[model samples]
Target: MSAHTQIMATVAPSARFDPDLGVIMPPSNGMPRSVFGRPVAPLAKWRRRYAACLVVLDFVAAVAASRTVVALFQDADAGFWDQRVLGDTVSAFVLVANIGVPLLWLVILAGAGAYDRRALGRGTEELNRVVRANIAMAAAVSFLALGFKKDVSRATVAAIIVGLLVYTVFVRIVARVALRRIRRVNQRASQKVLLVGRLADALAVHEVVTRNAGAGLRPVAIHLPQYPRSGERVNAPVPVYVGWDLVPLVQQLRADTIAVCGPASLESYELRKLAWQLEGTGIDLVVVPQVTDVTGPRIHVRPIEGLPLLNVEEPTISGLSLLAKSLIDRIAALFGLIVLSPVLVGIALAIKFTDPGPVMFRQSRIGHQGKAFKVWKFRTMYTDAEQRLEALRAHNESDGLLFKMRNDPRVTPIGRHLRALSLDELPQLINVLMGQMSLVGPRPLPTEDDDYRGDVRRRLLVRPGITGLWQISGRSDLTWEDAVRLDLHYVDNWSLVYDLGILWHTVRVVLDRRGAY
Candidate 1:
């Protein structure tokens, strides 16, 4: 053991000395030894303001949907107005509904936790809740209409429901986009975090925070459990400190959150004691486990007796979901081919005339289950591209089994524009229809790089893709390790919704052209 461990062991002979949570607990008095005023509360006023704005937007959407449907579908000349609904004329009933529906929508939204601060501006949970609430509202209206034997127009009700769902979802998406942009510019709406753990783990969490600016965690300082040595260099970007007293440090730093990353030494009881210290101080405690890349949907918390067990479901690799995915891929690919036939032909003609080469380039690529398939693409390189590969190897800008050059001599002039816009990938729809590729999955590797072993082989569990997490994330700019990590993550967490999200993001990435060659 090092000097620090020896000192800790000698200081507390019987007490549990957790390496991550090395702070010595106070006596039963529950008072901090050193009082540095009080821990500052995070800037949560924006969450309240944001939630209030959403409420207003949702109400407006409900009102517009109902009123528009009523005006368009309701026949003013029809004798329906003469009929009474709950002791009011049909026209009066319409007015009541215009007010009641929006209120009901708000209530449902609240019950579904759509206005929750935790869900706002993060993940798909808020949108999922909104969808659920709208669905509940539709069911409730249908039930009330059927039960009361009211002559409510089914067509009008359906239209209002559909309109409300679409409009409200669109509004929330726009709000999220705007909020992300604002957060990137101004971090006042973000969480002030005091990172705690070993240096490596803390740095990892910090990297994640920096990468995902919208997550709203700004690390102010890091608290290491070890004593600081004089002249010892710490490579962290944030200020680093060592001590048993954390509350005072948090207060001094004005950090409202303590993120414990990969805290291996702390028992559950000891972690609970740490939570006690933050009680009534409004300090958020976040524990980041060692598990990486597992998304929220796959993790479930099961409380049995007093132990809260985390159950991680197996990844969806096969079964009905895969079958549905396959069917959708083929159907969409066929539709795309038909709709984009003219553009495809134009591109083919362009390649034939400008590049003086074949319109299509077919290469042997490793696909699902290590199967080799001919992946097709619009020819974007000279006919002697393969012959020129040896000469350009010295100028390669990528690492480990991938060759990437920002300006390759083998690429035709027209090829550069096609690649920048990702137009060359359009022909891969044929591969999708042929069951050799997916509309969204890990991008297939050329046969030369097919040294599948260990974790690298996992990428082949699903069919290769026309576009994937790698394509939208950074493409050629990403290191080989990062590319593999992303591909493996997509393979382990494959879902229909995820695929759709990737496809949607692909459009933005293509337009941005950040990492494309």
Candidate 2:
């Protein structure tokens, strides 16, 4: 055999081979051992210290902002400067309360995962979460103040809240920008990652790591299963190693991290055994879950004796949660109807002037519990659009039971603009107020024969949403499987936070005019 073929044969043994530790190892080829020519100790220590410092800074900022508010109002009233109100006793109490409240707020923020590096500099999601957490803290404090009959004024409380929000947002933005700059400066000093997975998953992971180099993951080697020979090296900058070679290769590369992407058709026992073998190797092992977009809060790990059992709870949408959602939806819909009445009237007039049809189109759609409800939307299609659907059925691009066309001929001129901007769906706010739908949930489907089946029909368990996961993703551009996956993910991880996130993304997607049919 040729030298390359002989090397492959020796590495491709069916049974695992035990390595001799006394065997002389190959010499290093003068490649630099340390990334960026610096030791890992100092960089890791700096990152941890930086994170702790941010927490401390946030706590201090919160207290300082609260104190500023209190001091500002103290000078405004002579009575506010009374001995009991502004004396040392009250000052100490206020100090303790301010510090304790922000610390508690930070705990809640941590629980909500606001401090994750991945979410930093992403968008307003993290900021909104911080605001919501502070709001919750404020509400709790307000109740406590009322119960204790504390003489705290409403204006003082409001000022503290406003100040905390402003200060926290400013700190978060500045911290994130500074961290991004630091990561850029230390780009090559990041963690060396060894990716272990099937070939396809490894490729996908490489793409993600390459796209976000500042995230500090540098994939130096890919460990592919079964294939004993190093496969044709793709254009990606990483080296590929195969089979049991990973054990020695990881040692050779001195990688600090190993990310195990989903296994390819491997038995669970084998996968677990592989994981066990990698333990105590001075490398952090991260397992990437198969489920996507299901937030961390939805997943629970329980240790049963020796086995780790994963528990995924079904999304809750009943009792007090249902009541809270209903109340918010009704209040929001009422205010939206009042505020947008003029715009609604103008759109109606424009539609009437442009087309000789009714301003609104009410269609029977499947609602919660498979009940039929008439969902209202501004007429965005010709009056005979429903009749014309059959003729365009051959051009349908959506998967499963949904019918969608990118450029249908039946849409009115005004309707096209309305659909593009999602203005046509504003009438569904009435549906929300009328209790036929929710502000966030799976999108309502027409009760046509092809729309649902079996477990997929569980989407009707809660009120349908006007703008849901499907809307923010790609609307009509999403395949049937993609649409179902997103809806199911929502069902598994539903929360008020998720609802607000979808609502926020909806605005961006609408403005971008993505996936509108």
Top TM-score prediction, candidate number: 1
- C-alpha TM-score for every candidate: 0.86, 0.67
lDDT of candidate 2 over 133-252, digit per residue (tens):
778767866887789666666777777778777888788867765665566676643567778887678777776566444456778766666543344433334555543444445555
Q: List model 1 lDDT by residue over 1-517, tens digit each.
A: 6433453444334324334533322223444454335544544677778888999999888888877776776553332221333454665667655778889899999998999777887767788899999889889888877897767666667787898898899899888877777777887667788888877888888987886566677897677766545555565676555554677667655667888878563567767887887777777778887666887678888999988887888897899999999999999999999999999999999888886768999989999889898989999999999998998899999986778999888889899999999999999999999999999999888854449878999998999999999998778888999899999999888898889888977897899787888
The residue pairs in collision within model 2 are: none
Clash totals, every prediction: 0, 0
Off by over 4 Å in 2: 1-74, 78-158, 166-195, 200-222, 228-258, 263-285, 290-295, 449-451
CA error at residue 436 for candidate 1, angstroms: 0.7
Candidate RMSDs in order: 6.4, 8.5
Quantify all predictions' global Cα lDDT against the true fold: 0.79, 0.70
